[model samples]
Target: MEFDSEEEAYDFYNAYGGRIGFSIQKEYGNKVNGRIISRALVCSKEGVKGTDKQDRRIFSVQAIDVELASDLRVLACNAYELMGRKSSGKESIGYLKVDLKNYLRTRRQKELLYGNAA
Candidate 1:
């Protein structure tokens, strides 16, 4: 899915069981190259200017696949077409919220009926 804003992108990742933490590694001189690269969608807020103040609001989604530009473009275009709105970030947030709510309900049911994941 396309993401219009960065926060929405992060929220999507978080919904996918991705955690924010640290990874232990060789700190001194071991630099991993291709093994650590991640492809993601990015969103941005545009800035508006005025004499005193300006409303700054814009959303963007980017897909990175150097050799698969056509695929990425198609995906983005389809997402836009499907959403029927310009904000992909908003769509991502809505999806995440729905998923999280369902997850919480299932977790509660499991805890009430049985014991929890052992």
Candidate 2:
């Protein structure tokens, strides 16, 4: 398929995704100088997932999923603490807070995208 502009391609994909009961997102792009030469659009759920840093881990520790915060304000407050007693009452931080934020943001984006889908 060919499009005169990137916006045209996006609009085409977005409309198609709406009809197919899914969401579209800009996946990747290649540019020459300052102009975009190519663009990739894909389903909202498709992407490189967050990965655990294996090299730094001394031993395998089973992670317990916990609801850290219900709202944005609480998440902001709790983001600073490094490995406090939260999960299993153990003083250990599994991952960096920035990684957690990114994970949440990605998850929230997918939810919003699919929730609005037709």
Candidate 3:
């Protein structure tokens, strides 16, 4: 079940309805190969909030039902590691950031209107 790349992880998340959003960062030069990658650690916003701190909320690429999950995890981890490099290029960082921000804003607005954090 260990994923060999991050794409598998991303696809899995997407299939499971856990993906909020994703984008690939743009690169002008060819020094770094352009790769389709996810920029954020995203999950289903409807899941149990408190469970994120427990084992149930942990993101595991190796625990999937398929064999390529490990590779996906590795790819995601590598993307995160190289995210700050000048030579490296991103493909989805912008979209991911925007989605996260909008999601947060919506959540806050709902909380204010409902009077309960939910």
Candidate 4:
């Protein structure tokens, strides 16, 4: 595909991303005489998966359970509820159970490391 201008390209990709349930971002541009000559648009989620960022959120939920001695199920429910509020009817993710399991395993490792395990 070809576009007459960078703005037009951006708008086209942005709309495409919206239709595909993601967002587009301007990655970078080549400048010549203070004018954008070339640019790249990409999905906002590019190169972001399998990172510790989302794990950090899970750790936050783990903190709540540790401090309040809360039930894991309730914590998962509340976390998913909050995530859903930010999205539409679609759930935050399908990995809540896996996250909870990771949290429990991590907590056990920590307890063992700090002599808190029974």
Best candidate (score: lDDT): 4
**Models sorted by lDDT, best on top:** 4, 2, 3, 1
Tell me the tens digit of each residue's lDDT in model 4 across 1-118.
6689998999999998899899977754444445655565768875433534344234343345433433444464565554434333223332354565566568779889999876
Clash counts per candidate, in order, are 2, 0, 17, 0
Q: What is candidate 2's lDDT per residue for 1-118, written digit by digit as tens?
A: 8899999999999999999999888754544444666566778987542344531121112111313452334563364352233332222343555555655566568778889522
What C-alpha lDDT do the candidate models reach, one value each?
0.33, 0.53, 0.38, 0.56
Q: What's model 2's TM-score?
A: 0.40
> Please, what are the lDDT tens digits per residue for candidate 3 over residues 2-107?
3556666556656655344543321222134465333333444443334222222212321221114223544433433344242354332222323333444565
The order by descending TM-score is: 2, 4, 3, 1
- My TM-score estimates for the predictions, one after another, are 0.21, 0.40, 0.24, 0.37
Give candidate 4's whole-model lDDT. 0.56
Where does model 1 exceed 4 Å of error?
1-88, 93-96, 116-118
Query: For candidate 1, lDDT tens digit of each residue in 1-118?
Result: 6567545645665555334432221111111231212233322221222233122212222211211333344443444333333223333222222333344455458777876643
The residue pairs in collision within model 4 are none
Give each prediction's root-mean-square deviation over alpha carbons.
20.8, 17.4, 15.5, 14.9
Where's the lowest-lDDT run of ten residues in candidate 4? 86-95
Q: How close is candidate 4 to the true structure, as a TM-score?
A: 0.37
